[model samples]
Target chain A: MRVAFGEAILRLGEEAEDMVVLTADVAKPTQVAAFGERYPHRFLNVGISEQDMVDIAAGLALSEKIPVAVAFAPFMMRAWEQVRSTISRCNLNVKLVGTHSGLSASDEGSSHQSLEDVALARVLPNMTVIVPGDREEVKEATEAAVKSPGPVYMRIGRDEDVKFLDEPFRIGRAVVLRDGSDVAVISNGAITAEALAAAEGARVDAMVIHVPTVKPLDAQAVVSAARKTGAVVCVEEHSTIGGLGSAVSELLSSEYPVRVRRMGVNDTFGESGTYRELLEKHGLSAPHIRRRMEEAAEKRDR
Target chain B: MSSAVELADLRHATDVQKLKERIREIRRSILEMTSIRGLHLGSSLSCLEIIATLYFLKMRHSPHRPRWKDRDRFILSKGHAAPALYAVLAEAGYFPKEELRTLKSIGSRLQGHPDLRTPGVDAPSGSLGQGLSIGIGMALAARMRGSRSRVYVLAGDGECDEGQVWEAMMTAAHLRLGNLVLIIDRNGWQLDDRTEEVKRKVPLRGKLESFGWVTYSINGHDIEKIIEVLDSAEKSELPVAIIAHTKKGNGVSFLEGTNKGHKLKLSEEEYLAALKELEAKPVCE
Candidate 1:
């Protein structure tokens, strides 16, 4: 995902000379080093200071420069205040790329996992939150974020090759990977691959919708899917409480009012383990999503 | 090259007495605007001279063209000082001085903090420790464009307690942003108590120097000294930090050096007393 982001931003830098990339000493991990190596003049390494990086990005944006600040997702939490006060509040044109989101950094423990990032990013007014599913979507989302006129927070996973599809990508729009009417499996991030597999394995005839833009969500598409499927199951790699699951449920409960089941980490801290083990332990694995989809489909029949 | 020469000419052409008079008028306007109930009174008062020096003599900003691309930028990091900044902007003809009364009111551009919506405000900042980084960003952008514009950031002593400020200081030095100038309003007092009492053993100058900034210590209330140091700092080849020692609530004898003046609505007696004191003092001693 970071590789895709790096390539996309490098291309963007060539077109937009005012595009500056900032990092807090995590350039290699965030894959921003590629952009930095190519455009050293436009790259800013602000050491291990996330808060300063965010505020600096806001400043650059105010100066009419498109600045993309990259860091580990959990580390971005340190600069949450600056994000809220400076970037979002002022509605600056700054792109915040948070990598290694969710349990992708499982071995780094719960402290490194950014399960609450979606909630934090979406809560800010004038903030657009996006979680691209794969390498292709990551590149698309990075381009969309740069084009956005206001603040954007793009959450990218550390896991490589999470299954890419040659689907049309647009910000604030969801893509239907497969069409079914029994149940709607709404998911985002790298976990969308698991969602697709869950629908197939369960044979639940589910409508699989992959949402890359979590905030400013394609509400019309989600509503149409819910109305067609009659039941909804949300999947994500983040916390079930405020990530994709909660976003879909919130939209359905208020607008369409459907029976919804959320599949993700129950409100609990993550432990150090392999990415696959962490996914299964947190009920975000393919099998867990399959069972959740089956339950939603059964409930729909009853 | 012409702008630098114009700035130098303006610095000499400026009348010290007239600048002091403008400061007095601005101070009076701030009091009148905040007579009912005000926020950040002391914080605003301490940095009056610093801001006055910038808007009147130093900064290369055009009130008529507030969004001029090559103009110098000023970020009020210590946001509670919005009234002081507003006063300067209005005096500089960014807007009518009458708009000062609408400060902190609903549907008014003069928000309690510095907002970019207001004319002449380059960036919205009320959050502490964040403005320095924003200044760094602006400075970096200016350097990238090869513009002669400089970025000035005014922060409070207590605001320096935030870890982000140190991070920005390190970044500015590392980036070698010579066009950035940070003026610290070392007014001694904060909201709850004296800054020294709250954050002891952390000398502002020593900390900045250690972070590789060119540090300058000056009396903030002295308009001439503020101008002189700013001129020198602008010529330096490194990021500059001006530690301006000032009274918490300068110009008002009763409110001076008192934390109680941090935020308050002046009583009838206190208001009258403050006005009388300000009126009695000479424009420049």
Candidate 2:
């Protein structure tokens, strides 16, 4: 997934002369090294300092440059204050790419996993938070973030070669994959692949909505889906408290109240495990989402 | 041509006496604003001359064209001193001097911290120890665009305690950002205690030098000395760090050299006394 982002940036860099890529010494893992290797002058390694990288990105933005600062998802927390004060508060044109999101870091343990980044990034004013589910969406989302003005936080996972969507990708727009009226299975990020499988395996006619942009959330699409199905199930590889599940529940409870079941990490830190094992242990696998979807549909009938 | 005459007038306009008067006026404004809102009195007063010198004598910026591409950038990383920055910007005609009275008031552009919304403020800053990194970005951008613009970042010595500041220092040197000039207002005092008392002591000049910066130690209160050091820094081939030894609450007698003056609500009597002391002082010799 990060490789897709790197390729997209490299393509964008060829056209946008003012675009620069900055990393805090995680270029290899985030796959931004591809852009760096091609445009050596445009790429900068700030040497393991996320806060400095963030502030420097703001400075570049002020100078009329589109700067993309890439780092691990958990590391962005070190520079959250800079993101809030310098970039978001001033509405600078800087893109923050946090790769290896959720439990995608696998063996790196709880300290490396980023379960709270969405909540942190969403709270900032004028910030666009995006979590791309597949490889192609990662590329498209990177392009959209570069073209979009103001600050953008692109949360991606280390999961590679995930299934790409056939539907067109747009910022702040949700894609309805498998449309059905029985239950709405809304999910985002790397776990959307699991969500698709869950809907198919559950044997329930489910409307699967993939929300790429978390902030300025496609509320209209979510509301329409909730209205159509009357039962909603949200799955994400993030904390259940403030990820897509919370976002979906918040919108539905206010606009169109419905029976909603959120499937995600139940506010617990993830331990060291393989990505698949962690997903299964955290109840974010296909079977768990399927169970949640059935329960939500049954609750709606009751 | 008339452009030559305009340039001549600008040169003639900023004599030592004129600079002194400007500093005094800005100091007065800082006191007035702090008297009402009661914030950052000591640190703001400490860097009054440094801010005044940059605006009036050193930096190549026009209030008429605050966003001019070729203009120098100023970032106040130690944003607690925003009153001083606001005063200097107003003095340079970025906005009306009358706006200084509304400092920190609701709906005022003169926020408690410097923000880009305020004319002439290059970046939003109040959170300490982030400005150098931003300045480096601006400097790098200027280099990338083939522009000759410089970036000046003024940070507090106490703010240096933040690990990010050192990270920025190392990165700036590693990049050899000769267009970047970092001015540390070494006021020696912080809100809770003196900087040395709180942190392990290291010779600051040596630390910066070891970090690969072309370092200078200067008397921050002296406008002439600051101008001299800035002139040299402008010609350097590496990033410059000016450790400006400054006194907190510099101009006034009662509050000078005290951490308690960090932020305080001044009574009418104390405010009047401060104004008198500031007005009676001779320009730095």
Candidate 3:
């Protein structure tokens, strides 16, 4: 995931002279080491202070530089006030790349897990929240973020996520992994792999929509899909609140009001375990989504 | 009033009386706006003359071309003190003087803090202690772009309690950004209590100097002294730090030197008294 982000970053640098990157002591871990090695002047490592890193990024952005600040998701939370005021308030061109999102830091436990990052980032005005499905989506979203006008929060998993899409997907355009007519399964980030697996178990026509950009969401596409299917099931590896499930719920509530069943981590803290075990323990497996979809379909039949 | 001469000529001319009148007018604007808006009355009074000197006789900012590439940039890092900044910007013709009345009103671009979306503001500031870093970024950009434009940032004394300010200071000095100036509005008071009691930043100049900054101290309300020091520092070869000693709520008699007035809105009687006191003060040096 980090390598993909790095590749997209290099491409953005070639396209935009204003592009700059800052890291809060996470350059190596986020795989921005090569960019740092290549563009030493444009890259900054501001020690361990995430708040200062954000402030410096905003400062760099004040004078036409498109600053991309990279850090662990939990550490990025330390700079929320700066992010809200200096970046979002000013509407500065800064993209915040938060690595080890959700329970991707499973062994690192709840301290490093960014379960609430989406909720926190979504509330800030002028902030675009994106959680890419895999390495391929991360690359596409990073390229889009460079052209994005204002602040953006992009979540990328620490582990190598399941890659379903072989082609570059347009950001904010949900990719339909499976084409069905009865129900649409909406998922994002690393968990879209599980949604694809669960699609095989559907008794009725089922489709899986992959959303990379959670904010400035493809509302038109989601509404159209839900209206066609009459029912939607949203899944994510993170908590049900303010993640993929909540984003879909918000969209459904206003634009595409449909019978929706949200399958995600139901407001629980992730434990110390491997990523696979954590997903299984939290019922974020393909079978869990399949079971939830069948039950929703049964209710609609009644 | 300053010699009946244009702003460009004021740089070389030391007309203290006319400049003092400019400071008084700035104070008048602050008092009137604070009475109407009921916000930043204390902080506005605190940095009245500092604003006057920068806009009137110190900085080279063009109102017609706010985004002029060669113009100096100022960031109010202590953004709650935006009334002073707005009053200065208005006097500089960044906006109409009458529009100052829209302060803190719904849909008014003059928010409680300095918003870059507004005409004169270079950066959005309010969440404290981040302005210096932004100035550093600006200064670095100017250097990289080979432009001689300078960046100035004003931080509240209390705002120094934030760790980000220090980080910015370190970055600026590390970069050896001679084009940057950091002014500490040493007002001694914050929202809740006195800065000395809350979080003392004694030897403030020493701390900045330790970061390889060329430091200076001056009476913040003394426009003449401020201009002289700033002029000398601008010629220096290192990033400059000016610890401008000021009284919180300096212009309002009832509020001056009082911690209670740091963020308080004036009542009807208090407003009337403040007006009377401002009217009695000498208009010029």
Q: Which candidate leads in DockQ?
A: 2
Give per-residue CA lDDT, model 2, range B168-236, as digits (tens).
Answer: 999999999999999999999877898999885359999999999999998999877898899899899
Better of 1 and 2 by lDDT: 2
DockQ for every model, please: 0.84, 0.86, 0.61
Give each candidate's interface RMSD in Å. Answer: 0.7, 0.5, 1.5
Question: Which candidate order results from sorting by lDDT in descending order?
Answer: 2, 1, 3
Query: Which portions of model 1 show Cα errors greater than 4 Å?
Result: B1-14
Question: In CAPRI terms, where does candidate 2 land?
Answer: high
lDDT of 3 by residue, A1-302 (tens): 77788788876777777778888778888988778888877878877878878877887777777889999997898889989888888778889999998888889898998888888898889888888888778888898888878899998889764678875766567777888877888988878888888889677678788887777788887887888788788888667887777888887898867888877778878878999888888888888888877766656521
lDDT by residue (tens digit), candidate 3, B155-246? 89999999988888877777788999998999888887888888888878889889899999999988778888889878987899999999
Candidate 1 lDDT:
0.88
Worst 10-residue lDDT window, candidate 1 chain A: A159-168
Candidate 1 on B148-229: residue-level lDDT in tens?
9999999998998888888888889988889999999999887778888988636768988999999999999987788889
Model 2, A1-302: lDDT tens digits are 88888789889999988899999999988888888999998899999999999999999999999999999999998899999988999999999999989999989999999999998998899999999988888888998899989999999988646874987679899999888888999999878888888888576788899998999899999999988889998888889898888888888889999878888889899999999899989998988888888778777833
Residue B42 lDDT, candidate 2, scale 0-100: 89
Worst 10 residues of 1 chain B by lDDT: B8-17
